[model samples]
Target: MSKWSGVLPRMAITQRSTLLLFALAWLGVCSSFTVIKDGASSLYFCKELDCPKFEEKYNSTAYQIRMYETSKWVSTTITGLDYQAATEEAFMKLFEYIEGENDQHVKIPMTVPVINRIQPGLGPVCASNFTVSFFVPFKFQSNTPKPTKKELFINTLGQEKVYVRVYHGFTNQTNFPKEAADLGDVLNSTQTYDKSYYYTAGYDSPFVSHDRHNEIWFIATDK
Candidate 1:
């Protein structure tokens, strides 16, 4: 046997060990502090993809309180008499922006909870205002690309507390209002939140027909 044969095998083993250690370290750095196998956010139905990071401040059978960090989102408004139709139109507009219809012409990864702020009309015959928004992926939050469409723009939501009520199955015009009303009923009498406008959040796609998750968010007031 050559004198250097043993040294060669030892060197190969050392190289493998260093590579393994480096990989493990890389993973540790990539994983956020709030993420874990069974963390609060993981169990809160943000399992499939990136989502706005939040700290669960309170929980109960009726509803939960989450303090969400300030984040930016791409949003567009649609006004119509029917909630379903307006929301559909708004979704496609935002979808196009994410599908490379922006100045950068870059495709951004979709995120969870397609949230819509609904400002109910004053009268039954009036059109309601629907603002559909998609969370900007964390990587692009700092410098979001400008949308090609004039109506679409990026908006920043400041750090705020929200009362969230989780629901299952599909959300539509008929069901979301009912769900929001139910949530309002369950809230404590002393709880202060915005009643004029509420957010409907969908965490799954229409194609995902089962085990879907949705939510109604009432912005908690400082008072």
Candidate 2:
């Protein structure tokens, strides 16, 4: 028998029910897709074209300014998985959804910097309440396909300018916050950025090492 099969029978009714609900929720998020509205464009990060437009390269330890265009995304909020595991799980599920596992049977190209943000006011930032998003390519932005599952949804982000700090090396629960705090200090000294909410963008796959790129973005509220 499967590992879960043996443990599930021994669980209390309430525990069993909770586990079942969580599993179902994850399934829904992984499988569902919603129809795109008219005139709503989808957007993706293309290093050859779009990335250069938004992100300006710099040679400072402080921050660089980036102007991002509004874009649409497919995302799911997972409550129990840690940063790495959540990202991995979310990506696979989204990949499957786009690979004809959804209601639309559409295959979409993947984009860079799979976004991971900590949900605001969600107590402390640990494993729970992390949102993982995949950018929907521009071709499908205007008329996006829907997911087959219920827990997955689409969201639109408005255009904004932000201050970003790029870093190298692998990210984890410990290092992420530390780097964020360090960036926060740099921004605090400049008094040029608004730190209300910051975003973490990862550009490389787990396999890539050496010149990996990761960034912390703080929205510019001064403008």
Candidate 3:
């Protein structure tokens, strides 16, 4: 299970209310993907404050899998499932694992981008998304410093054990575009990364510390 799924209830309602306001006011919140009632392969969301009800196709096998996974429900029958079936099973297993999510391991943030929707035409064409990952030991305190790059691992076993050092910072102030471009140039020049449509989200590190995380994640997608 992705860490972001676990933080909602623990969050102060004030923050949630604020985010709700942001979503309704700024058109900035990422839409929640939900199942349909007796429908086919599809997902939908309520984009307005007056959204009457969460409507979906309940009979969709895909929707079942989506619910089992996103709602953190799982079953052993999910094993050996392929394609859509496999997705549901995987979500079930992950959801169960996330039930025991501890603060020490899960570091969900206030906002999470699905990645595939934000920056399209980058995923599948090259890498799924150019996510430049690195690690900062807990000793870094609150001071940001030059980060060292690390290889990211796939969740082939479905165990996401990333120990990210978090930080806090304001965006749109630094030369983010230049930094991203520079990192892209380096990654492209070295071929350390599979491709360059994405970038390293390491800029806020030197400003924020390892103890606090204001992760700068870039979204890559295939439209």
Q: Pick the candidate with the highest lDDT.
A: 1
- lDDT tens digits, residues 1-223, model 3? 8786667656767566654543342232123212223221222211111111122222221111001111111112222312223322232333222233322343211111111101223333432222222221122112223212122122111211111112234323244344344434432232332232332222221223344323222221210
Off-target runs (Cα >4 Å) in candidate 3 are 1-119, 122-154, 157-168, 171-178, 186-188, 196-223
Q: In terms of lDDT, which candidate is stronger, 1 or 3? A: 1
Q: What does candidate 2's lDDT look like per residue over 1-223, in tens digits?
A: 6889877667767665654554554455334433333322233322321121254544377777777778788887777646666666676667666666666676665555677766545556444666777777666677878877777778777777777788789888777778778877776555466544567787665545677788887777765
| Error at 121, model 1, angstroms | 0.0
Error of 3 at 22 (Å): 9.5
Report how far off residue 35 is in candidate 1 (Å): 14
Model 3 error, position 211 (Å): 8.4
lDDT of 1 at 201: 90
Rank ordering of all candidates by TM-score, starting from the highest:
1, 2, 3
Clashing pairs in model 1? none
TM-score of 1: 0.79
Q: After superposition, how far is residue 173 of candidate 2 from its true place, in Å?
A: 1.2
Better of 2 and 3 by lDDT: 2
**Index of the highest-TM-score prediction:** 1
In model 3, state the lDDT of residue 45.
Answer: 17
Each prediction's RMSD over C-alphas, in Å, is 17.9, 8.2, 22.3
Rank order (by lDDT, best first): 1, 2, 3
